[model samples]
Target: MADIPAEGLPPADYAALCDFLRARTGLSFTEAKRYFVDRRIAARMAAVGVATLRDYLNVLRFQASGEELQRLVNLMTVNETYFFREKYQLDCLVRSVLDELARNRRPGSRLRIWSAGCATGEEPYSIAIMLLEQWSRVDEYEIEILASDIDSAVLERAREGIYDERALQGLPAHLRSKYFQPVRGALAADGARWRIIEELRESVDFSLVNIADPRQVQAFRGIDVIFCRNLLIYFDDLGRREAAGMFYDALAPNGFICLGHSESMSRMSSLFVPRRFPDAILYQKPAEGGAS
Candidate 1:
């Protein structure tokens, strides 16, 4: 098979591919993203020995195994994240949200927090560390930190719980020393790679999830809090609304949802009430019998 030209797919093919991707993953792409998309598709095409863009699209649409589509999805999804990337939100989790939730729960009740779009485990791992360090009653309740992402490759890395210095830049030196141990024989001139302590690693449950899919999202219910920051910008307006609605349903009454700093839940859904704290503004579902 001939190689795809450096110029990339034709306009019609590009549009078709974009539409297909949006329908399947809820990720919106404009002409500006064509270069990014084309580069990845070209790589997949070369791997599968499919030269033309149209044939590649056909493979994605009709391939019986669906393995190629999964590969493409893995490639297209971005997994840029770091420990303590958004410290304010974590502060809100410990200082405000958990206190309010605990007020309504029994002493030994379960507390569930979901980190949707958790890439490479940093966000959830950060959540665990914050809970340990800041939450006064961390040991009182049974806390579950569920981290999920659409990218299987990143999920594998998340489960491993190993990270380089770049991924830990925002993490404080004190916390770093306490939670991470240097990986043996993985030293570099810059620094040694570190692995999250085994206990912390086991605290977070990582899984593959596509928030756009109602069936997949519905599986999670009665969640106390949700952290879905810095991920919804990829979705179109309708996709955002759909995901927000699913999240609302996933939460228990009066449960909280935290979006990216730049994201506003007000634009996505009216079902949540915005609660402002000094650290951050979080969205909350109305309790049973309360107005939404």
Candidate 2:
């Protein structure tokens, strides 16, 4: 988080930059947030040796390789998440959501779960590990787990599936042993690293996605459960509405949506009704209505 002096970025340049980012990623910054965006952009500009916001915008717009835009997106998006984060919701998914889906699923149909805005793969891998733990005869059921993030760098690291001990802190010891093996490095105990076992690693498919893109988000169809934690809090009103609609469209009838504990669809859309479980609360797309 570099701190750029507000006086450096001209108003016109800031507006153009905002419009560009909004069109591409559906994220918006307010007047108060202008400084945040400016600071981050200034950091990128410094990295590229471009002194002015206008010049950087030109590079982002006209660059042939499109690499600059990717770098900008990587910088702007937040990827803070850990293994077994918001454990109560995950417990609800395993205890209630999966059981309901399993009962209704037709023979040989794969149970599909999507981890939208899955940063560094921890969320989806956590889900996979949970499913394996909950379902003893896991091979008897078909499963499809898709994890996506806006940041390509984090996605690559997630694919590598290596993490320090801190990331595994929330995981139970027995489950950790079963699913992960030590990395080659023999560092200090707290700093020691481990890799997710090949079985769990292969079980998930990771991809680059901008959830704000309607066409791209609609590709997720027939999904039974979606873990979209901590994703929508960044969007403005319009972006939130669009994302809510897209989620509704992507879900199957009666599908469950588990958002971040702090996030709510209460004011955004009526398509998803709130459902309360003992451990957590979640939203579900209506079983009867056409997606709004």
Top-scoring candidate (lDDT): 1
The segments of candidate 2 whose C-alpha lies over 4 angstroms from its true place after superposition are: 1-8, 186-190, 290-292
Off by over 4 Å in 1: 1-5, 186-191, 289-292
lDDT (10s digit) by residue, model 2, range 1-292: 2234557566776788888888888877666777577778888988888766767888998999978988988888878777899988888988887877788766677888999998889999999988878765456578899998888999998998988877899988998889889887454455689899998889899998899988788779998899998888878888888888888888989998998878888867878889898889988988899435
Q: Cα miss at 79, model 2 (Å)?
A: 1.5
Residue 122's lDDT in candidate 1: 95
lDDT of each: 0.90, 0.84
Predicted candidate 1 versus true structure: per-residue lDDT over 1-81, tens digit per residue? 636666877788888888998898888888998888888988899899987888888998999987898899899888888
**Per-candidate total of colliding backbone pairs:** 0, 0
Report the lDDT of model 2 for residue 68.
91
Worst 10 residues of 1 by lDDT: 183-192
